[model samples]
Target: MKQLFILFLFTSLFTSAQTLETIFIDNFEDGNAYNWESEIGWEVINDNGNYVFQGTGHRWAVSPTQRNSNIVITGKFKIITNVFHLNLLENSGRYFFGIHEGGVYFNNDETQIEDVQKEISLNEWHDFEVFTRNDSLAFSIDNENIISYKNNTGTNINAKLAFECLDDAQIQIDDLIIKREQIVYNQDAKWVKTGGPLGGIGYDVRVDPNDANIIYVTDNWAGIHKSYDGGRTWLQKINGIYSRTGSTNDAIPMFCLTIDPNNSNIIWAGTFGMRGVYRSTYKAELWEFRGNGIPNVENLTFRSFTIEPGNSDVVYLGCEWTLFEDEVPEGANGASRGKIYKTIYGGLNWIEVLDADALVRTIIVDPNNTNIVYAATGIFDRDHIAGSGVFKSTDGGENWIQINNGIKNLTVGDIEMHPSNSNILLAATGRLIGFSREPDSENGEILRTENGGETWNEVPVTFPSPDADDWTLFTYLEWDESDSNIVYCGASDRGFYKSTDGGRSFQPTTYNAPFINAGHIISIATHKEKPNWVIANSYGGGVFVSENGTFSWSDASRGYTG
Candidate 1:
């Protein structure tokens, strides 16, 4: 079924002013339909030096494209036989014109609106144009207005243009020109949860680099949800995903997800239930176990995951083991218990590269230099005997060294590399949980390193301190791709914070943004092209969206039951 209704999210560039821009043009002169969704029975053919689209046989329809604003479509159309219809379709209603032997008739869906007895010859091309602006529409043929109507319904824009032939009618279309007018909408548009995986904690959100409409979100207990329509709806893709208990019926607790930059279809996922790592070559439709080389997969829970930008096959996996009360293994003190695995052959096999006493929380590979890698460690379990800080591996995880000279808090939850600079980086310190009792369990601070971890400094954050012994960990950190100075920090208990001065200072948003207050923010996502859009996933509150950056937020968890 065609999705007629969709949430049209316009960029901020179009919200302030009106501008006319040519959006689409298809002459079929390039011998390709480009974005036109031509049906099976439709084919581009050349007739006397003119290239045009024609219906080969049987009932067929072709949709050129769709727009979210007012559009003016001009094209040439010719009918070979039978009946044909030109449709401007939307969820609210449909404005279509039917050309039959009787006459040219206009209808708002099934209800006929107008009819004219003008004869249109078969196999004779005629200039046709469709203009839809505000609540008025006009259809012109041969530069003469044939049907003019004012739509009472509030569906003047956001419609798709399609050509259909009925009763084996043959048709030919060519020289299509589509133009869209920038729409000025209300700035008070609020976010609403479309529909997707719910009931479990959404840990990671990834948008396809090649196509923004395709989205992937990992849930702690829902395996993975794939959205092909910009997240309006989702489907659970867990064909080969399962929990550690070997129950395929139950959704696996997916902790992390990463898509190969070179190939969006190749996906890598990590589990929190000792399931190791899994890979999907065909997007997230299916999964296969790819944790062959790592030792003791049943005891470790995986979280941090990253792929080298230089080489997609070169990947890193971070795993950690939980330590219970007084259940630490003998001789485990001062010894690394958590493991970091490296796979150069795309997860076909893995090798234990580094083992740390602290849980490996995050891994970052330098885009400028893939050989240089950084792994941030922190422990959430009972034992905090080993030092938890950032580790640097300059030779592609072959060897490792600690680089926590100036960082006061070592439990780094997330690290973000500057988009245009490699040395400039930011890390968010997290808190420790479990049975172990520590006087200062609350750790919520932003640390910056401009010299590639050689020296680190703290970025002052003004968030109110949590109660004594209560943990308030900074769970994630993300920088606006369009502006590196705009950084966002997500906390486990302190809500959200933003920094506009390149991490020099941070301001808390919970005081004014009540929708995200006290919510355990697990992940923050930002688009490089869309700086005004921000999405933050709360552990229990579901999702929150900020249209004008992180200034204000609204609850976007309508479909989410979690």
Candidate 2:
């Protein structure tokens, strides 16, 4: 009887594996559509009938719906484009083969895989396959081994598949084939130093005022890292910083980091995770929540921070307020609905002064007077929304007046005042938003105000039009502290431009910077100790250091991310 039972068990396992066959296939040809519905928690989009495998339903979703075992799925997909918009969650959720796993349907808390695959994009039909054998799982794209998982205890043996297209995307899929398999491939990259540049998304980076060699960088999805040897080697200082939102493989994104120039020991960091802002008096050895005055709600993005040059105690932060669809004023503000706060005594108390129903893009203090300040607000609406223009407050935050008279229909991004001259001000302006489609529309021009922003005029800079390489607007502008008359500007589509006579006339820098062309310059800071030692921050191309006044450049993003 025992021998007979063992034979029956083997037979049952074999039958289960064989029975895992293709039960349904929708080519969209037989006029028969599958019961397709989007998961309520996920965002879904349909391509223009080009991605359909058969008829007209090539569904794709970001942050896929999690599911469980006993499945064999395959599809013939052609990437056609180099865009793969997969937001695969880690540890917090499960991803088997390439399909994510978790949700209530799986009868468990969200379970996620610990590994991620590089974005697969080949403009040809590639066969994708996924299979599971009890506690083990495997996946492949076009027979090219991708990922495999083991020791996973999950239920609800079903999964959801969809397509994704965020920017100028197109794809096609057909001839889906599914079958059980006992073979699995090893497809994991061993953690080898490779002696190459450390790569990851760097959210915020700051140079230690006390020790220029000592640099601190916060990874947007990784934990906080510090380099004592000037970005040579990085050590993770995530003792108190939570990284639960990131993959066990990746780091949580630290949006902003600031160190008190007066006291390098006093450090502050703002995280984009479930945990909010954290402060460490002992240089990030240990940290505690410092988001008391700021909102404690979810998805609160702490963007820009400015410390009073003379008074380190006085700090200002630009934060993105949490806004729900129902909370908006019925098409009044569109996607722009955040606020700016200031704290005179560190984080003890915060005052909300500017509520323009728009994002406080950039904030800067008056170079001559600390009390006088300027804040640039603009609509963050992705589609179609207006900008709040530029606002100035002579009495700190007590009152403000829109100083955007000459600057009509311009969305202000960056504001910089001459270090020595209070009346000389330079602002970086664009159209209503960053992603304007109008080609002929004047995208960006440096506006100058010799009379403290009471009036303004466009500087003579040959801004590239949409026809010329699809270039658009200027991102960052900086005036030299040594010579306030010397200014530098960088654009997203175009490379770099410089102005010798303040904002009167401008010319492109000697360095074309083609490799760094796709990225926009974020901030340009001059070395206080060294003359002509300038550093520029690229949005995605990391950082560049220029020694010859923007005439020559070198890559300085040794430990930086996009």
Candidate 3:
């Protein structure tokens, strides 16, 4: 019996060095189809900007060789058929559920699978999960455990996972996840969750400036979480987070987090849209709403923010409109609504200091002179060239001027000021790949500005694996506080990178990043006390830690998922 379990996971290509997590994921955003063996009775079309398959009765879509004995497939599915007959991997036995039939059915043996009387509507969207394991096949709807069928009779090799509909039925599907083996990351790059109550993607992470053990991480759709015992455990520090009805975990999203340098207890979380900034004063134990001058209008998203080093009361926020959607609203204009705001009186009020049409993602204040500030505008794959240049403000941000003179890529991803020399500025710019099949384009660039973004020059950097030729874009640049010359840059899909020079050239770093499967290299952190200790955050793969240096990494994502 145990041999059957072991046989299900290990394919011929399986090796001791690497364990596969997710082999293939078809979110269908390409507007075209690939890898399917047959498209009979089915067509891939752009469903209001989301790619989905619209299939007719008796359609089949085959897959490539998945040699492992077990398989798991999931996606949002809806069928118009009165009786949905599905032949998974083989035609010898039929498995399906019908609105009229009342319960799930397996044709081979009625006792092989259990009956769960679940109602699936024709037009409404429903998620389905199916898996093969332990000489049994299981299927479920909306994550409910519904059916388990004996699986010894089907041919394993050259087998195909298929679907069949009856009576001129039509079905639609999206966000397909298919894998032959369950994901268990290996030793070199394992991810352990930092006990995040919210189990999705993390957009931002920060270690407290005062306490190395205190850390803060933000969920893409919920409140801020804090870990007192370094990241071993996490506490949802959302006493006053602004959110709608669901668990603060399901809110619009906490895009960024910042800890006050002077006061560790004071913190701010940037949220999506008009929810603006949520602040916590008493050790993040309780939260309260605080947005005075920042526009309270709809669609205003706070992307990036910063606070003055000595004066925690002074804050600068880079904000822009939420531009993309599955379907553009009728009569809605795709104009850029990027701007910067400032507040010197804590959160009592805010004042708009600059009005740039680019989507701003970073706001930096020179610690040497608070009067000089810079804002970076641009988003992944978004073309805001007319307004998407780095801008700077002198004399306390009263007014701004476009300072992107020599910089080539206008789609700014990040902007950083030098620690030793405040006049030296570093900028990263790029856009996400428009097509899923094509590699990320070579539009991203790292620029250096000695005159505070007045004139910029390209900084030479090398991308990891697949090497510099494969590097498409660069974002999320970090500096080693203990050694300013040792800098790190995230080469998006290309991989993580390092630079020994100040801002001139870079080579791929020692840390092996897995965001190619997880998310963008969003946030990378170096411990305040330990110059070599590092933590990198992924869009979905959770957190990774480097204990000895950049060369060694382990999965810190254990408790992140529920």
Candidate 4:
């Protein structure tokens, strides 16, 4: 059942970096273990002639083979000291490489700190390597030249290569390999497609601060798309943003897109029931409605809104209705009418400033005090304690303050500043312990304040969190218009994070949580003239672009494909 093609020129089986794209090669003579998680007890032994893996003590072995890579697992083992350790996870922390009775060791995902030991061991069946990409990580035992290390810890690597055995270690693994190194983009590749009225769920992407290829992208079910060519090719404007409100209808769901940092064609559109917001004086090309003129826009659900990085016609609208279970509207528990709206002359006119009870998500003004704003709070479905933290406004939006002192699990999922120290603030929280929506057990944190929110600190997330399953929900946080210590966080589900030390520590980034949803990441943008050209928006994974900032990322939706 084998045909020899002969011209395999292959060779690169681990001289450190010359891979040839082979995702897996488990040579256990096929005796079993095919599904691979070996279930904490590993066996499959044949001993000397090979087909190995005999375990004892705290045993375990896994490899579901997650994605993003430059990978290299290479195997053949017989250990002692730390005996046999091997962990993997890129972009969400923890990427260890081990063998220790007190010698040959490694640690990355930037400082989970096994600290890269070295005692050298090669007493018999040797050979072991562990390679990574984008910020290096190399570890070997009987070949590929022993230890060499480096770690950025996050560029979105994918991991699931376990094999534990903590204490009395005497393992014997054999001939395994997992390779990944193949990326060939560029057939005019800027992700080019702009093709259809495609699938749906692309959250928000605006790009066109005067045309870096004129993009627009917004779709819950395909509401607006207009690419003057950056995303290759597409057009589905939705004639004024679709609706039949009285008959049959389709396109009109769009989540978020605010544009107009001084008129990039003056945009704004956040619809998803109650059409509460829409206006595009030509850039997303033609769409009007404007939130039914906000007479306290009812039953609500406009999701996100913010403008006024110094008056983009002064905007701020974050609406969402219904709070606390039984669909309370029967008395408006904790009342927050219209959730918070204020459109000074751009969406015509409207005002309802602080209806604060949570569900705001992001609204950081203060690029030098446009009245100093900040509105982060969240709680996707009403109960995780209704809605949580962060709401400061030194008078601009009039009045508000719940600063969330020294923050810790307060739902608030996004807020940034430090494009040059706007008093240095960064909040991208996580919480939902009760009535879970799945942060498994409140996993999310990156809170810092240099006196802005008056004091807060948590910033140390290489992301390998799961003492029991903290699901990692840091929605979005950006810093790097050009790099203020390079911070970036986006994980509605688990797939983006990188901090060069401004927020103290962070590393799991390479943005690919199974391409979105498995990694959620609601929204993120960069490129205030190409800050390495980044952009991410995915609740359902559409629209991802990282010219370089996150190292490499693509799929800027190419027209929301069908």
Candidate 5:
């Protein structure tokens, strides 16, 4: 009886295995691929006597073999220069598995399915496999599963295989094999949540005015987070924050976190998307929608926020009016410019103080005088180039005037005042690649002003030679409190610069550990008491610390979970 039962089980297994069959296979040993349709940058090439398909530039090659469902694709790929993609074309849509500079991703149509931040070694061969079962697709690299996603947009049909590479990418593929596999669907299977890797686009970090242990950070998408233990651990503080409905995101895009200089409990936050400003009166533990009189909150993008040094009720908000074809204001005067808004009653009422043609990105209130204020104007992308300079107001946000005299580029990003000298100031010109492209004339200029924006002169800083038509910008400036002459500036493309003779001249920092030498530093903070202890933030490299001054750096982004 036992032998008979075992024979029945063996028959059942054989019946299931018989459904899988090979559909198409290619080794390219003969150095010919007549069945593949090639584009301009794709060709069959011999590598060390092993023939393979090589693709360069933004081009693709299609295979003659086609399958609808329950298909398996196995191949070996190597990126010689940049990145590549394997595309599955369907009648209604397409799916792609691509390797990018930062990592790998899977996308259907234009929507992302999964993204993994990994640096794949270049010029090394790696095995990949993709399996499709109904609305589900499973992908693996080197026998290790990377991502498995289920698409609810119906089953992809009339599938054809294609190999492609992105701009300036040189990729090679070999040992292509296709099979028709019998895939049994597991109806009870569901996706489980696993925590993703830490670190993201950290826009701003602020320390508590009274206590050094309290810290707050704003993410581009994760709203606001706070740490009471000096960034060793953080807890999400997005209590009243709300993202747009049906956007598949629960976190709001928060930027420009400002803590009141006199009141540590009062903090203000500006947002990136249409969401308006929020005020946190309880030290960032809870928030409230405080933007009441700001016009067009649904189409406004706030870039900077500042509070009066002495008065907690007075604040400023820098914003850009996002242009919408169907929702343009009745009388926009043919331009969607940026505006500056001021509120004296702590965000209860706001009035537009200045209307400029460029995005108002940074607003600074004079620390010594409450009546003096400065607004810096520029944008990431826009059509008009007007109002790309700095503005000064002496009547406490009542009136403003342009102050771009002797400035090389009017596209100023950030303006800073000297700690003890109000007459001494620094302005960093920035780049914004918008609808109307601006010229990449120079690698961003750091302008020094001795007469408080009356006139400016370039800071004679040495920078790396730029690529042809490369646009760069400096995004931040930091001053060492212990030594006012020691200054630091951050750039979008050239990293960090230090100046010992105040802001007269500058030199780049040594590209030491934890720094990728590619620059892209955005924000830097210097301790007032411990001048040697500093923190710098990079675009994709996370955070770095320099305890013994800015000579050496180490990673300080271990606890970040953005």
Candidate 6:
């Protein structure tokens, strides 16, 4: 009897190893029409594209219904060329490797992949392997180790695989394979860096002011990530957060992060989803809930937060609330809402200063007069009916006045003021999506006021007319402290420009500068201790640091996140 049982066990093991399920086999001899179904959800543009099944081109789509836990997904992908674009537009242009398990997709879609290993080649056949055992998952590409994921919730695992395309990219694919297997869990593998500028996605990077080495990054749907040595080593920080709640999505969207400039020990993170702002005081070792005075209305999200420069106890928050026609139920109470709040005593006391049915985009304090403040507001829906335009408050947060006399039909996005000259103000605005910029529109002016907010004039700098679609939607302007007349500005697609005569006339900086084509300078901070040192934040690209003004640049993103 013992001998018979041993033989049976051996047979079972061998059979299991040989008969791993084949998911989808695509030779791509014809076109993607036969083996794959092309479904474009929210892709901006779709052009037919070829994709290698294994070399960062293939993606999975888990069925919307399933309840299994342990799953094994393996395949063989043959790359036909050395270079190929992995277009993920079919799945909202977001996901790469999606696992639909127990009716829950890995990142809310079957298009999401936690990690990918870069090894498969275009001229050869390679093995692709993924295994989910217990509450963990592993991926191997071409027999090489790739990445491992720990499934804390032990959700069901049921998913399918497919290919994605974007911008008419092209490549060849063949010999696909898959299997179900059980394996030991491991957490020692590194993450394969993928996706970026290719998609409109951006990352929020947090730098420890005291130690620039410690950095935290959050991808669109990948959840919170941490890097101890700048961005060299990264780890997923999704312990308390769900990778995928409803669909097969595996991301935690985060917008703004603020580390107490005075105390690097304190950290604040504003995230979308059910959970709002998260606070960590012990250097992010642990986190606690801090969205006390904030609203919990549906779709209301916290976008940005600013700490009082002199007083860490004071904080301001900006939120975006909107009600889309599709978002409303058959019958609802009212349209969506948005508001901006100020907390004089940390988060203990909250006051709503700007309450509108629109989103509060940007807020800034005059460097010369801290009590003076400015805020830009815009409607959130397609109607674009009411916008608060630019608001000014001379007595801190006590009172506010509409400063839109010379501004008309403006939907403001960002606001900036000269460090030395509080009277010099710059604003970025846009027309309704489908409309064109009118000469009379107040949407594209680098407004200047030599005497506070009493009056304004169009800076002589002839900005690309609002009709220039290539210009950045949310443009940024900054005045050089070394020379007040020397100002620097950047747009999303229009590249970077410099003004030596205080926004009167502008010229492109040297092409060699890092600010060129950098896109929306998120924040520009001149090093107080180091006079000529200026740091500029790029949305998709990392940070660019210049020692000799904005003339030359270096990748300061060594410790920063993408």
lDDT of 3 by residue, 1-562 (tens): 5334434433432343432244445554433334456556777776666667777766666544343445677778766565554445443444443322355665542333444576666677788777665455656677666665554555443234555555577777677766655444456776654454323656677887777888887776545767787777676666434454236435646777777767888887777656557677776666545665565566777777688889988888878765565333333334345777788867656788877756788888888888888888876544442535787778888888888898776777788778789889888877665511124435678888887776999887664444554446777788876678877777664567777887788786654544425456677777658787777776655666777657767666554442
Kindly state the number of residue pairs that clash in model 3. 18
Which whole-number lDDT from 0 to 100 does residue 219 have in model 5?
A: 68
Query: lDDT by residue for model 5 over 312-343, one digit each (tens)?
Result: 88889998776666544443323356799888
Candidate 6: worst 10 consecutive residues by lDDT? Answer: 98-107
Write down the RMSD of all candidates, one decimal each.
15.2, 18.7, 16.8, 21.5, 21.7, 18.7
| lDDT value for model 4 | 0.64
The best-first sequence of candidates by lDDT reads: 5, 1, 3, 4, 2, 6
* Candidate 2 segments exceeding 4 Å error: 1-205, 209-211, 223-225, 229-239, 243-250, 259-265, 273-275, 280-286, 322-334, 379-385, 431-442, 463-471, 510-518, 560-562
Per-model C-alpha lDDT, please?
A: 0.71, 0.56, 0.65, 0.64, 0.71, 0.51
**Compared with the true structure, what per-residue lDDT tens digits does model 2 show for residues 258-282?**
7875678878787663336666777
Q: State the TM-score for model 6.
A: 0.53
TM-score of each: 0.60, 0.57, 0.60, 0.32, 0.60, 0.53
- Tens-place lDDT per residue, model 4, 1-562, is 0011111112332344343555555555434444457655577776665557666677777755565566777887776434767777544566666676456556664444544455556345777777665555556666544555444544445565777776666677777767677655434536644465333566666677666787777776667777776665667665444432313454466767778777677788776655446666667555555542464333566767778875776788877654534644443333222267877766655677877555675787887778888888774324333455788888878788788887767777677888777888888876444434444436667788888888888877765555522566576787766667777887665567888777677878686523433226677766566667677766555676777777677666665542
Clashes of each: 2, 24, 18, 21, 3, 36
Q: Which is better, 1 or 6, measured by lDDT?
A: 1
Following a full C-alpha superposition, what root-mean-square deviation does model 5 have from the true structure? 21.7
Worst 10 residues of 5 by lDDT: 9-18
What's the CA error at residue 211 for candidate 6, in Å? 5.6
Instruction: Point out the worst 10-residue segment of candidate 3 by lDDT.
Output: 11-20
Can you tell me which runs of candidate 4 are displaced by over 4 Å?
Answer: 1-81, 87-98, 101-160, 163-165, 168-203, 208-211, 214-228, 234-325, 331-364, 374-392, 395-558
- Candidate 5 ranges with C-alpha deviation above 4 Å: 1-195, 244-246, 325-336, 379-387, 432-436, 464-472, 510-519, 538-541
